[model samples]
Target chain A: MEFQSCFDIIGPIMVGPSSSHTAGVVSIGKFIYELLGDYPQETNIVFYDSFAETYQGHGTDKALLGGLLGMNTDDSQIKYALEKAKECGMQYQFEFENICEYMDHPNTTIVTAKRDDHVVTVGGVSLGGGLSKIFMIDDEMVSIRLSAGDDFSILAKPYQRKEKVLVKAI
Target chain B: MMEIQSMKELIEACEREKKSISEMMLMVEAKKSGRDEDTIIRMMEERLIKMKEAVDSGIKDASTAPSGISGGDAVKMSEYVRQGKSLSGDYISNAMSFSLATSENNARMGVIVATPTAGAAGILPGVLFSLHKNDGTPYKELVKGLFTASMLGLVIANRSFISGAAGGCQAEVGSATAMAAGTIVELKGGTPQQVVNATAIAMKSLLGLVCDPVGGLVEVPCIKRNVIGTSIAFSAADMSLAGVESRIPCDEVIEAMYKVGKDMPRTLRETALGGLAMTETGKEVKERLFCRKS
Candidate 1:
């Protein structure tokens, strides 16, 4: 196995609270938002596995909502995201599923968001040390990782079959 | 029946393995840096100095620990709530504050995990400190213990999984607890087998621990969870040392944790929409502390 550098794992800048719970959640939300390509008219988030049990305690609700609203991981507004969602007229709901019963990682989230004629569904996992991977998107199934300083809008486009793509955070 | 091995043999093996693995990792790092031995040693020496300073501070904090167990103690009390005994929130809060204060102070010296953010940085360190204190372990052992724990984490990073948003608290606290358990076993002179078993125990116990923080802050239940995670690490180590075997391996345990976390709903995985955050009391606190326009 290839040993990873600390910098490769954690990244440059992060906010308080947690990398997995706070930053990872925001990154996942941002990725979903970018995938939708616009502000979601409504979002239906299902917290599977660990997300279901502890989402409330981890501020993931606000963090993910903030991300859907185009908030950065470090935005302090993430704390008031539920209220912000209400203020912005964004509709969202929370539900718990027995993701654990299927024998999976405890920290998994499946987000499905819909905008005008556009709907995106994805699953994300928040690896510790400020790392995360978008395992699936729109049921097309792709693995995408967003690091610090990454722009999801540009990177979300699927690479052409003939195009050479190297996995490096810019 | 299987033959029982001597504890000294187990300790020596762990020491040798830890030394070799750590040396190998450092060599890899050195190769990547393309730096000479002198520079590498100098850098390592500087890091060692910092770690030593943090350990000194930990000792000082332990020396001045309040009467009764501390924040971790309240968490432990909470575990036994079913026995009809409970601690007041003020007492629990004090313990958590003490743990947080010590961890934040340590972070300044660059010692703790600092996780995805720095404010909750104390959780990992507080857990480590509590484990060592409760076990009557030596300071040097604790330092080496962190190294062992980090090694397990490095392996997980290499192999399958470790993420909170990805895997929930299983990856965060679960990973930390697993690392802590492995490190504690190594500190207690356990063999690799025991270390892995301890790690598996830790991971399994908190397979679905969520990353929820109230008002998007790392305070609230987060502090208590850290304190509790440490105690869990201690028991895991002790149990593994006492010949408890996990039916599942560490890697599989981690994988299960990931799968379980993935299946969890957003409400439980840090959304703050469920659990204590969604309670009447939680809503009241949110309104009182966070509702500025109200």
Candidate 2:
């Protein structure tokens, strides 16, 4: 491709103790929460590959649980999500398994949740460069590949419901 | 007979074209100035023509070498590159000295790329040095390769994010190595096609490489990964120059990387709860380190 005076520089001013571990999981968890349509009394998250391996050390568990608890990407409560999970009375457990078995990427996670009868199983892939894609939801695969720029909603087609509640970015 | 396509050829073409454009503009500007217009135009034309000839010659002589490092080894190597030596080599030794002489009070964040996040930031230098020293390549071409690689990285960032915690090391060391590989190939005078090929090869080879940092730090495995990444990048460049096409396109590989990362269990990505971190050594290291730090 011929170079066309590209001038899009992302400045560094983010709220994060760690951009990848903390913020990324928050985004994925928040996206999952969005897919679920409503808050669940119970959540069972099975972190495949990389997600399960490092969730505790990276605080991904907290990020995911905090996000499900309606926390934003920059929520300070994320540090306390594990302890608070019990206080808030939200039931959750993180497990691990090789989903694809042969692929090289280790940052894949399949989050399945049930809000009463509304069950949602969404697959989120965190491709490097702070970008991620939600590939599936509730057995029905969602083609929500994360592209450059803000196309979050457009990618969330399968998750869209009449009563879908959109949470504001934090 | 028509000339074969090569990276050197393409870059030289672009350079020649750029020179021609510059010369033409200079002539137009000189004409507007209304003095010594013919002299200025002639000089610019001559310069442009010389550049074109050089580009043509450079394209005819490009060879490459393949990387032998494995997917995991690449990551380890990248980490090693980051931790600069106490003293050695031209580029890094100087950079290391400068880093040491400079006080931490006024230090800035160095984008280590696929290198070690801290301690050593010499992977790029190492890759560039190897390309220049081992391949007998010119310095200017290296700059162009770096520029091209940066552009590719921007595209990836535009398309997706490269955070290790978010996307695992595939985003961190993985993307950085890919970026480095693309640059290396470009420097080797590979075609844009080869540049893309090198990128895919690097990314594909490093697909699923985890960010299992021991003791929850960017040290250890992280530093080693940087060294490996630089080596892999060099190898990728060589492979591309040798006409090895990475069957998958870079974009698709990137997408697949994302998909595969999504399927990865959280343990391996940087939570320090999987892989080596989960091992006995990892646990002991973490216990000792965290206890000391706290």
Candidate 3:
């Protein structure tokens, strides 16, 4: 089951207008933050389908930025994320699309971000009730479930490619 | 201790374990996450505190959301309820105000718990706090009520859907309303069977409801629908308490909701392309908002 815990249904305790559009998107952006181990200096976001249509009303932009800045879903600082991004010297842009080629869901976003010399592209779908899944990492199709309760660092470990380690194959 | 797939199985699990739904949920959480009961309850209690904060702030703040479409209604409702002019008793009127408060707070991007989904967040808090106001139920019991709510919501979400984008408003608000109904029954000392019946009744009432937000905002009809959902939840709880059994089983009702949601058109499912979103005022609001933004 995609939803395992009772809290998944009852409590993300998020700043909201939507669980799918806002809270779930926050998790996806936060996933990137955790995976990258730091906030990106520059980022590009593509909001797809319903996310593109009603992103403003739902505060989807603010939620994503808040997460990218390492804010949790419940952080009210989401409302001022755009200003905070500027203060932190984090450059960002948003592109709207009717569909995300990586996923067929209505609530989808693909983000390309740069942190120093390392850059990664991540695609995600907000699956509602503050639940989300990472579908693509650097052009490779991958499935990683991200709920509010999960250890994001662990869930994101498989896709985190830092300095290449000498492999001793067993 | 196995995962539950249906209400029948859930009840059987509860019966076999000789525990209340809340107790069963706690056990399940402990087993699934490997966390102790105290830690789990503390986490839930923290969420409860956040819910209280949202309701307390929302009822007092008369300011509008940045979108300028939703705000101040919760304050107005609260004042009206205080004046004792409402036809519905203080219980329901209080719930309406609370529901409005949380939903308006949601529009403002304030922190609140998503009982099933944020779009439908207000219903559970509205009903729960109202129960507290009218009956003086302790906060601990209400926290347990949230567990009961999650138990019901988990089944419906797993069986059907809970996001408007995926299943229209019926899945979002409808699932929340059903969860609230069952929760109320369980908190009031109703049987597990009764809780299931209440859930079925509440879900059946709003089957096939569309997600049609004006300007693609969670304002307009969405807020009022949440307010109405509290009444439906209370009514469903009362019916179940009074032995009003749903002719259709809870699991089947959830299946029907799934089918209805699957059959819903893309335009009606948060696409802002049909239903109230396509009405004259809805279209005008969209245009006005777009023009302002551009």
Best by DockQ: 3
Question: How would you encode candidate 2's per-residue C-alpha lDDT over B187-288 as one tens digit per residue?
Answer: 655666677788889888889887677755444465456656766776787789999887777788878877877776666667677776668877887776
User: By lDDT, who's the top model here?
Assistant: 3
Q: Can you list the residue pairs that collide in candidate 3?
A: none
Predictions' DockQ, in order? 0.14, 0.07, 0.80
* iRMS per model in Å: 6.6, 11.5, 0.9
How well does candidate 1 reproduce the true complex, by DockQ? 0.14
Candidate 1 per-residue lDDT, tens place, A34-150, comes to: 766656779888876556645553566877898899887656567778888898789898788866332255567888788765666778876556566787765455667766456
The docking category that best describes candidate 1 is: incorrect
Ordered by DockQ, highest first, the candidates read 3, 1, 2
lDDT, ranked from best to worst: 3, 1, 2
Q: Is candidate 2 or candidate 3 better by TM-score?
A: 3
Model 3 per-residue lDDT at A153: 75
Put down candidate 1 lDDT per residue, B1-294, tens digits, no spaces: 111122233335446556432343345445655776456455433433443344345433432111111223333332454354545233233323334543333222223333323333444455444444445656554445544554566665555455544545566667766766776677667877788789889888987677554553445565556556666776788899999988887767766775787687766655566666677766676565454423
| Candidate 1 TM-score to native | 0.54
RMSD of each: 10.5, 14.4, 2.3
